[model samples]
Target: MSENITLTVNGEPREVEQGTTGTDLFGGDKAVLVMRIDGELRDLFREIPDGASVEPVTAQDPEGLAVLRHSAAHVLAQAVQQINPSAKLGIGPPVTDGFYYDFDVAEAFTPDDLKKLEKAMQRIVNEGQTFNRRVITDAEGLEELAHEPYKCELIGLKGNAANAAEGAEAEVGGGELTIYDNVRRDGTVAWGDLCRGPHVPSTKVLGNAFKLMRSAAAYWRGSEKNPQLQRIYGTAWPTKDELKAYLERLAEAEKRDHRKLGAELDLFSFPENIGPGLPVFHPKGGIIKREMEDYVRRRHIEEGFSYVGTPHIAKEDLFYTSGHLPYYADGMFPPLDVDGQNYRLKAMNCPMHNEIFRSRGRSYRELPLRFFEFGTVYRDEKSGVLSGLTRVRMITQDDSHSYVTPEQAPGEIKHLLDFILGLLRDFGMNDFYLELSTRDVDGDKKDKFIGTDEQWDIATKVLSDVALESGLELVPDPGGAAFYGPKISVQARDAIGRTWQMSTIQYDFNQPARFGLEYQAADGSRQQPVMVHSAKFGSIERFLGVLVEHYAGAFPAWLAPVQVLAVPVAEEYYDYLQDVAMKLREAGVRVEVDMSDDRFPKKIRNASKSKAPFILIAGEEDRDNGAVSFRFRDGSQKNGVPVADAIAEITRVITERQNTDPTAG
Candidate 1:
């Protein structure tokens, strides 16, 4: 007879057989794909222990979704190996929104091959294959996976955590080695993978809600030194409807892909000769950039920020003082040896700004001194991470640093937060939330962060209180703080509901002391003033990229590169349209006459394709009546308006920063 034991399940005490498996305990509930035993996720096939807290994890839970995607990745790898027995597996890891499995194969996978693999995966999913987990010795793992060199190498690194690579987390970790066997219904193992897994009970739970997205070349373990492997990317959802929704979002994201829109709109380009992650803004893009700079420059002046200029490169020791070297060396360009001194392209502007604050400073009255600059900086971004303007090596930051007494730090942070929010709202992005990044006090990781315990505590509380007082939802991001201090980053959602980290407000106590900055206090004692760093438009190039995607390349009237396009209805009306264009230009509107020899309809088509906010059309009737027709971006027209009214309307739309078509209103 089997013995019984009491277990705390879902906050309820229950009696079950001593050797009850998770599947049997949960009675094979389809929704309960996995179970949490005492806080640790375990395979359903693993027997539950007596007197343990148990909770069912459904496919909708975040952890369960990861397991689902990871299990699906295993199915995909099994299908690939079945089709090509020579193919060897490297690693399969669950990533954001999906998972990807790397395989060392002789031939690159094509689109047709992906369809074949999908069918094979579907067959495996229908097989109801049970995933059996087995604990094995490291030597056994190595011998079993001897044919797969990558797996064997990972097995050798079984207990070493520091040397583990990105995808290695899915295959190796913990004190023990384990492998997951895909057992067929006939009680025979169909395939197996060396993994640290708590997979779903059966493959059939994957249902038909998974898809193979695409394939790309990826280095094994994300290291450029390793051999390149073909990586198959895929996504899995709990239901078909959810899958369809995710696919729709993907389609929308593809439509808003900034790189494609940038070229089509003639905004920017990344030339091969210039090097990766470096972009050249065309004339049209330049206009938008200039407008942003002009607006911010004027605003900074109003906000009592003294404009300052810094060089593009600085000596290496300055960064060591700011605590960036060694820790942040990989992200910085290699230093240049100049006259026995090492100079590096500036990767951050704070250190130089700190120098400016310490150049010559005194008195309490100058306590809240603020300096702003459109400083250009560069980072040694890897080629794989570069994506047009969004991830560029060269960046121009609207960087500002403020020095204030400890008592005044709170007020300064509030002012900066308001400035950032207003600036984002002006740019047509109003949805926002604040994320407070605090230092990780956890073991080992804590050493990566600097600053005394009191300093960190004070700075974290100040940012947290300020963010909370603003009534914006504040999310905690532990281990996300900069080396020197804590920060609050504004995450703004755009037109398509995608969040972009826009501005940052960081409080630094370490740098101020490191630089030995001091100011005379009102009590007649020298003290270190708190240094706060703020970047309104985190990086101008990246901001432009976000805006391009936010508006899908059809910018607001005020932000549109060419605010007005004047097209004549015929050759005879060209001179009349030029007269109207002159009036618009006088009204401070960016207007140009389309004098091309193309026919009127084609001219209109060209203007529409340009995505100009306003199009002015002139014809014989308009010339006779001293009027012109207004064509808005939505293909709507308000015809036969006097030239004066047309000019005033266009000027109003542009000046008011209208995001919608004027005619729509």
Candidate 2:
């Protein structure tokens, strides 16, 4: 039990303590580029076990790749300090798809400066400087960091963080603090950063597969009160091919940015005078919104859901009964005095729905009541956090609350999950993932939740069992649940690999008790019904924004605001084409006849740019022949199809709501 450790790394023998660091012996040498300890990632400063075999982690391993990127960020920070010595460094963490470092600089960095910084980063990596760790006392740490204001701030923050770790009532805790020193071979310090040590052995391990992305102004600690810091973004990967692919995808994602596409397509806008985070959808965008809602309503009705409507605002007493005052009141729009009493623009539709259920005493036969509503709610999202239609203050949720008995909750939950899967499929989202969010066991690590242990256990089990039985790959997210309940979040992957959460099925035992909702069972006793709150497309506006990005503004036939554009080859064919357009309009196709005096090609180009799924080219010859030239957006052309056949085909595509096949690309 007390033996020292001896391990072999890359065929080299090294003797160390019971906890031997993989980075210490093999980390300094040139044999291993990356390291792995006990099958998990440990920074070079981590201690290892006695007689345990240590293997070198390489760039090929997925876990090791982030360290490479983190090291690249350090090199980039060094380059920034070289140019601007006063630039104070902040923490840089490895993020998905890339890494970013914050800097308090004298001036903003431009595109030209990014190029120079990238060049300097390459030079540092080429130098192959050694990375070592240094241990110092708390007082010594403050002295070493005296020159850097931000570093001093970080040291101050550490004290606060440690106090938090101890608990609300402070208890004594002890641990040694350390820093990483990036020293050169000639005994000159290249760079020294106060970080928990875990880095590549030397700068040579980094490759040229890195890029410096755009610079953005970010507030310190995400709070506007702190000074604005310039953050330089960058991406790194193990291979040149992966890096190139990432850059290409980034370019494509930018092209499909929903805010940009919203204006270009005349879909939606936000007025500055209307205050921030509130979107006003134009008439054109309203068409798509209504279509999406109608689709959901029809499906829910078929699944035995009863449509319901509620008021936009409610009395403050209603919220108190539903227990929204302390936990969720912050996100709500401010209360206003109505007739000497307070009222709030409802932030969640569930409370109102609860009032409806309580108005009537329910029998056991009335169990599993599903109520559906497209309720609009208001929130007070600060201006700086708002972005396009994705983050809006005034939005509507496709919200539904289902009340089911404890015994029937599992089956009802499964049915709802299956229903959501079908709806997503219809909307062209096939790839999905599920996350089961639960309360953290170690609440002392942070703020523990306030629910009773028995309530927490029951709610967690309910959602967890449903998620397992649904046959979805379940990922447990610690400390991610709503304050009152646990939820199973349904996320979808877009055309790109990024995942977004679009639906959530939450179980709330607390809310039912808060409102004292009950049903008379067959035994003639009142019992609490387990409440299930579910939303398929979480919000209409947010879902539409996601659709815009997923389809890249190329909506399918059924959802296109203007599905068909009938362009006459010349003015000569206008009357005949106008007649044809009316027939198609009667057939329920969104058709518009081109009346502009512009040339036919220009009109066709405009229609294509509008992203209409169908373009009917009606010329004099085709009008006489009772035929039409059909052109598709994807560069496919069909010549001289009978007008009737073209109409039938277009209707079929619209009625079926076909999506692009993944195999096609």
Q: What are the per-residue Cα lDDT tens digits for candidate 2 across 384-424?
A: 77878778898798899999998888888888899998999
Clashing pairs in 2: 5-50, 19-48, 20-48, 34-57, 35-57, 277-393
Instruction: Give the per-residue lDDT digits (tens) of candidate 1, residues 491-588.
Output: 99988788999899999998889889999998989999999999999999999999998988889889889988999888899899888888888888
Scored by lDDT, the top model is 1
TM-score of each: 0.96, 0.92
TM-score computed on alpha carbons, candidate 1: 0.96
The worst-scoring run of ten residues by lDDT in candidate 1 lies at 656-665
Candidate 2 ranges with C-alpha deviation above 4 Å: 1-41, 45-63, 162-175, 444-448, 661-665
Task: Name the TM-score of candidate 2.
Answer: 0.92
Identify the candidate with maximal TM-score. 1
